[model samples]
Target: MSRLILRCFAVATLLVPVSAFAQFDIEREPINYLKGPVSDPISRLQMRLDEAEVRLTFDLKSGYLESVLKTLNVSETSQMLVFSKTSFQRNRINPRTPRAIYFNDDVYIGWCVNGDVVEVTAVDPQLGGVFYSLDQEEVDRPKFARHTDTCTLCHASSVTQGVPGHLVRSVFPDSVGNPILSTTTYRTTYQSPLKQRWGGWYVSGTHGQQRHMGNMIAKSSREPEAFDVDAGANVTDLSKLINVEPYLAPHSDIVAFLVFEHQAPAHNALTLANYQAKLALRDEEILRKMDKDPDAPRTESIQRRLDHSADLVLKHFLFVEEAPLTDRVQGVSGFAEQFAARGPHDKQGRSLRDFDLQTRIFRYPCSYLIYSAAFDGLPSELKAIVWQKLHNVLTGVDQSSTYQHLSAEDRLAILEILRDTKQNLPASWRK
Candidate 1:
């Protein structure tokens, strides 16, 4: 039920935070995401493109899209189709010409047929979500539209925790891909239920006996319950729903969509964690100038705030509150198998990225996003707490029911994998 409150200013756009939850003045604040000396991988690529170190060719049917995916380390199998007229280029998007989104571990690419530009969102270690765009027309020289304030319109709202980040939304839409704004919109995360997902999008998958808001155009005046959801179940192809031609692949993989659902907010949560930690520590320095102690002798609040933020990030990293899949959820796309094959495993070849479609998102109750730059870029103090907490939970020292969802074998395997593969963990973790 999380939705961004968007409004159009004369020319500049604003990410209007939810008024009910009053917090920081995110709009006016100097977001470090935009304040980088600009050294993220995506930014570096942008520099290369601008300096003619790299050149991109425009293709007639987006052949460049396929090549670009390969270049970005994004997979072709990671495609998901959305037909919502809710993007910046709403005038160009429709159910008949849905936008195709693709992603891998840290990057997301968005494409629309006949659209003016291609969108890119990448995670930056120190800066959080870094957004850019490439013109989709005939061009000899290609440059990314990097760090524009307008993109923060939708990306940097309460939806993204007041930081420039990404989000996936589900909404009731009419025939034209225009969301039925009178109805409630859903900003999806891993915690979202299956029933309330995938509206305004075309999903091709098989979820046995489960119903969702996908594959149907909502009536302008009707409630969500009015549609026959069973009619949309088990859809493996999209030719019937729309002209699947003019797109890279005809399939809008459901497994990839589910993975996107889980990762988008997971990345945002990590970004928020990093941002919060940085600010807290920065404020602590100001306290030091005031001759106030951040510790108990000076101020007990410093440790408390840092601990709270770290705990929230830890909860998200471990998926402590992920919604259970009631039915045997399976996607017809080979994506599940393909995605599983690329994991970094333990001595026994198990990974946190392994999917458990029958119950929840993953076999081990840990997010692969923990390995992302955003998680790694957390203030060392906060990251230290996270690493220690992760070690405790994995080693059965902190076996609360919140994490009890993980089996003893799962924990042991995750511990072994992290200890062996993940560097800079607490030394006691290996012991």
Candidate 2:
């Protein structure tokens, strides 16, 4: 089958990487996803709670949802509503009462009406996506526990490049909120076609002429794709379709949705790069020890692995394959302004968060997540390769057709922005 499947199977049997093949055991190896020490947002919050430094107040209506959001620094306006029965609490989510997701750069919080627990996911610098659940019941102490057993079944699939990460999926859901099995489902990304996006999600925004599969339900299981997507287009309000009073926000801002589609996969790419580099380096160490040469040159196989992983991260961080927008997209929840304002701007007053809704997602076409902890936490060897690749492309040294999307102006602007904003950039970048 795939190389990832081979790696998993090899790891399962050998518990270590072989001559050319490297084992990827999540538990015993470099990436101890579940057993390793975690410094994610939720884990740190737990430490504060144990130390009596913070208290999460619970309310009768939404339990600890509001307090948790405030504590986690996840804005309420970054909310997205999904009516599909896709989550662990799928039974509680439907067209009438949907599940709400709020997120910031590093953390995502999921809540449902009358749901048993508040789902939290934190992007650990080293561990990728770490899942946790907070109980709804009010007790003397509220704790967030790692919920890996169930979460990893879907998160750590081929979709996430065989790593623990998050994703956004679109499916044709029936009236009661069950996805129609006969129809096609999509794992949405920034490169996804607009017409096929947001099938079971409530999209609240305005886009002229362009039609998406949001804010509507499949009338028939047999003819799930027969519905007119135009009816869902230009939807500025989700209150008519579902009870918005229960949720923290009234709208599922399309801008936020668009950003999420890009950010989720980018996180997965970073995590994959991190995991692959660490594994490759460990294997290299083993080889060096066998040869009894402390200064042995890295194997070609190990070097290729590092380069490939860095290339993946660079492509995503630079938004190489982002789909161009056909029409001007606008959001009602003001998430765009809020997101753009939270920036590490250069002297030119430009940030990667600046949107180009008329033609593309971001104005500069570079991902703002370049400044994030996840990106910064990448292994030095992998990060160095990524930096070099970025330098080559940005400086016009590599004029290969693969990066023809970046114009001279775009390249110059991005280079300047990174030089001013990114602290850990290579010293040569400053020159």
Candidate 3:
């Protein structure tokens, strides 16, 4: 099922040992994730609502969902539906009544039919994915409360690289929408194979001869592998499977699903990089103070941390190991056109958002999220390392095997596009 920061119910049955989780000192020091001030879109909107600077009109059916999406600038074309009971309001979610998730570059909104509240996750500049919930009650000025306790149990786990972030999962679901924990569940990403993706979700697209685990359900938990995948393949209409009148859109566009898959981990990587770099620098400063040195250069330990963090960011940013499509994929919804239209194109009119859909997700393998606030908000030291490595790879200086997927033409086009579209790029990048 699709999610913003909700726990994957497939993994919910298994209790993870505390030692297995990577602990980041998020509560104290420079990266005070809990006590820190947040500048995420939801928090900004909350402030406006508090001052009556803006108004959110409520409707009977969807409550404040439509208004919240409008106020946050989240597009309805970015909608995707999930049928699995994997969210906070699991009792209300099923194959008959799925949760509709809408998102943009910076924010994600989750709404289930007849649910109590609208779940939200906004990407903060430093804190990564900040969770919130707007009550579905009919009040003059509805409030959005920041959530940390339950949301963080999954959001800040190892799946999100020990940072507050988002993830997309694919799980085998039963008739009632509960994920069959006995079956193989995948933490789907840009790297996930098409066949292994979209389980327990409603995917509306046409991918010729390429089968995925969507728009279908498992008959018996004991025989999860006996699913008739062909029955669910290349599904264009979802009306027969479930009633679509309650949702904002009639289709849960495959293009939107693909983009969502890619965006979640990319945002996580950015968040991890930001958090790790900040924490590393803070540790270095503490060590320096203990040593009584005011002008000590950064230690190797700190540099290593920065290097590791940068690698994580670059790996996703560069689309290392992204799954290739066997055939041309098409989405019925206008998401593909609308997504490509959000372009900071070069003189050649090429954008990072431009879809490939034939062999890969993007024509230029570089992520469009490089222009995201999370990327832009990275620590200067960390960003410097990232830029240098990116330049080396794009300029053909570092032809290591990790980036072999990027052809010469691909590298050149991406480099030129970044030079034209991206701002504050390093001087070496321009050259």
Candidate 4:
């Protein structure tokens, strides 16, 4: 198991009370958004809100969702439904009216069908992920309530590497939307196998031979053995499992789930790296104040910590141990097509978003999230290491087994794609 996951389990075990979950102390660890160079989308949007530069027009004719979707450019086809009763508003969620989640590249918007608040999570170049909620009833101004204490109960746990970030889980849920705690729950990521994913979420795709824990509800039982997964295969539509009338999109797009499973951890790792860099710089300044050389080997304690954190992030960002696909998968809801269309293709019409669902997720082995703002905002010292490693690995200079799955053609294509489409690539990448 990864240290990141161990952190999540350790913290959650302490917080899960005998009857219910206890509040985690979030203010104890302050996320220094105020002190740092900030590029968080939500904070920027809030700035616009404060200046009256951007007005969210709430149409009572449509509802808060439509207005928010327009304001954020979050696609309707990006809708995903989860009924695990895991949110702050868990009481409002059930199998019939599951919470719907939608996302684009930069932000995720979540709403329970006819629920009170429209929840949103946005990325900050420095802050990783931050949570906010807008009142569905108060559509006049539609102010976002910045949540640190309440949302951090789950967001700031070890799941997010003890940082304010995002995570996804696969839980064994009963018919009433309660997760069965007796069974082992998976913190789903790119490294997680398909069969071990999507326990309480709706999935729409055709998996040739693999069986997963999605598309089915367990009866009142404590045993994972009670749940049969054969019924969960090749689920192209979810109308039989739940009422689709209340949701925005009918198909849950297995492609989208896979993308999310990969991107969430990638984002978390990037956030971790960003935070580590800031902390390192802060400590370096402290040493300078004490009349000590910050970068001197004797005083490089913080630098060593930064190096370890950078390597941890690189391990995840490089897909060192990504899960392999056993079956040929095809997605419903045109999600694959839409996702591919958004890509800034190279001269040969090649893009990182192109899918290879036969043996793996991406056509190229590298994660497209390397272009994310979090990565772009990485400290120069850490980014140098990442770029050098990327060049060596892609060029077969470092022929480790972890990246042996990448074909020569795949490497060349990825290299060309990065050179052409990705902005501000390292000079070393060309060699």
Q: What lDDT score belongs to each candidate, Candidate 1 first?
A: 0.75, 0.87, 0.88, 0.75
Return the TM-score for each candidate structure. 0.90, 0.94, 0.94, 0.87
Name the regions of candidate 2 deviating beyond 4 angstroms. Answer: 1-23
lDDT of 4 by residue, 166-279 (tens): 879888888888888887889999889888899888888898888888877886575654767888888887898888877778888888898888888888778777666565
For model 3, the run of ten residues with the poorest summed lDDT: 4-13
Question: How many clashes does the backbone of model 1 have?
Answer: 0
Q: Rank the candidates by TM-score, best first.
A: 2, 3, 1, 4
lDDT of 1 by residue, 1-431 (tens): 21222111301111222232223444333344544555566777767777887766667898357656866767777878899887888888898999899998888898888888888887777666788877776666666778557887778876777777897889988888898888888988888888899998889987788777888887645674478888887898889888978887888887887788888887777777766666566656655544444452424555666666777787887887788887777776677888898877767788778888888878877788777677777888898888888888887899788787777888887788787667677777767
In candidate 4 the C-alpha lDDT for residue 204 amounts to 88
Clashing pairs in 4: none
lDDT of candidate 2 over 1-431, digit per residue (tens): 97567555533533333222322467867888877889889989999999989999999889999999999888888999999999999999999998999999999889999999999989999999999999999987799989876998888877777788897999999998999988799999998988889999999999888889999899889899989888898988787777788888899999999999999999988988899889888877766665679799976767878888888888887777778898999999989999999888999998888889998899998888898899999999999999999899999998987788899998999999889888967899989
The candidate that achieves the highest TM-score relative to the unseen native structure: 2
Q: After superposition, how far is residue 235 of candidate 2 from its true place, in Å?
A: 0.6
